[model samples]
Target: MPEVARVVPLPHEVDPQPQRAEVTALLEGGLIRVRLPDGREWDAAWLQAGGSTSIELAAHDWVIVLPPAGGHPAVVMGRIGPSARPPRRHACASRRPRC
Candidate 1:
């Protein structure tokens, strides 16, 4: 593949590449805060499908961060499988009852 030139969302040592990060917070400006593997936090832009049916990104969700390309800002590509939401519990089960 051809080498691509890009810039990170913020000034940091992390090279421009696809990386896994945990969503920490969602911003009002269509951006989100993510903590890198190095424990550094950065504000990044988000990209999602247009006509969405029901896909929401929440805190603690694992997402892919696509570093800026062609002068674009970093984007939260999308949430990965195994969401952060707790699994559904049964009322007759051991722990907490289902609401």
Candidate 2:
């Protein structure tokens, strides 16, 4: 009982839903990546905790991390168990400015 980091809450959001090509090839062959919670590297595409900076995910909602100008609030990583392939369609592809 040692690998703990589950603030759970994000079963859906950041729409344009349509992900099942083997779950977008397991998130483009990298298999999801959004770990935050003070560990950094969220690279947001959509992960709000409450009104404003909205993306959409209503049904017992509770998100966080609105950073920028003294940023904070993290944790967005996914994949918590077995998945043969079903949902897919996630985002966040705008971090290519380090030439």
* Best candidate according to TM-score: 1
lDDT per prediction? 0.74, 0.32
The prediction achieving the highest lDDT against the true structure is 1
Per-residue lDDT of candidate 2, residues 1-99 (tens digit): 744443434334433332211111113322223433444443332333344333333322333333322232232322223434765655545556576
lDDT for each residue of candidate 1 in 1-99, tens digit (9 for 90 to 100): 944544445557547678899999998877788987889777787664553326677899888887655455668777789646788777778777569
TM-score of each: 0.56, 0.16
| Sliding window of 10 residues with minimal summed lDDT for model 2 | 17-26
Error of 2 at 27 (Å): 26
**Model 1 lDDT-worst window of ten:** 2-11
Model 2: colliding residue pairs: 34-77, 37-75, 49-63
